[model samples]
Target: MDELIARVSAAIGVDAGVARTAIGHVLAFLRKELPDGPVAEFMNQMAGAHQAADEASAGGESAGGLLGGLLSGGLMGLATKLNALGLDMGQIQKLGHEVFGYAEGVLGKEKVREIANSVPGLSQFL
Candidate 1:
């Protein structure tokens, strides 16, 4: 997790704290939105990723899945969620690029691509 934070911080020009928060939010979003599959397996391989996602879940950082109908509530809810974290749409897209690139490095392109395609409105960011 520390290493992921460091890489994201450097890649996105954000501080470790912001990177951590953003990463937590992104991962938590993915965990909630993605079906059980390679993405989940890939997330499982990352140390502390689930913990971060769980923390977001427990803290209601993701609106406690209030957008449940959006599957849950699509990317608008996610954009709103990320916006609350001080990231504009461009920054969020950059974060997506960085995080997805990083995930590809770890989990390979095919699996990461699968993850992106599986989530509604996620491929646009990717």
Candidate 2:
């Protein structure tokens, strides 16, 4: 998890804290949008991911804004949530690539592809 956070931080040019929060938001969004099986597999494979997802689920800076209320599901909502964490679209895409790349290293390409494909409009991020 720390490796992933570091990679995202360095690659996205954000601090560790911001990268972590963004990761939490993305994981939480996936938990909400994906089926139980794939999400469970991902959570199990990724250490500390459950904690991050839980934190995001509990709500924080990203959940309270007016835009947060307006966007509730799918990729648009995920983008909105991430944007609240101070990432632009390019950074968001880079974050996704780094995260999915990390996931592929841990969980394999097929698993990551399955997870990404399950969500509509998510392929663009990959």
Candidate 3:
């Protein structure tokens, strides 16, 4: 995943370090924006939903379950909000993917997801 993120970031011509910081910010924003269902919730969601994904990959359940859950649960709300504001889920997903993809490229999505998901009161940011 680290290599993948780096590969993608390099393809996009962004400073890997800057991309990492941007990912940190995006993770923070996700927490702040979805205070009620922030990173912590995402962490649990990821942990809880691990089995539904493929087990053969090296990234394993935490990446699939925890990170995937966070994306589905937390970002789902974001999609709805954007839709309410005259954007569609596709646009929201695109914007989120761009933002998060950069971040993942920098720091690796799981790393950012783990740290961000551990904080308390992240929901307060919403």
| lDDT for each candidate structure | 0.75, 0.83, 0.40
**Candidate No. with top lDDT:** 2
Candidate 3 pairs with clashing backbones: 23-103, 32-126, 35-123, 46-65, 46-66
TM-score of model number 3: 0.32
Which wins on lDDT, candidate 1 or candidate 3?
1
Tell me the spans in candidate 3 whose CA falls farther than 4 Å from its real position: 1-29, 33-76, 112-126
Please provide, for model 1 over 3-118, each residue's C-alpha lDDT reduced to its tens digit, 9 standing for 90 to 100.
78887788767798777877887887887777488768868888988887776555544453554334435677667666666678778888888888878888888988899888
- Using lDDT as the yardstick, the better of models 1 and 2 is 2
Kindly report which residue stretches of model 2 are placed more than 4 angstroms away from their true locations once superposed. Answer: 60-63
* Candidate 2, residue 111: lDDT: 80
Arrange candidates, best TM-score first. 2, 1, 3
C-alpha displacement of 106 in model 2, angstroms?
1.5
Ranking by lDDT: 2, 1, 3
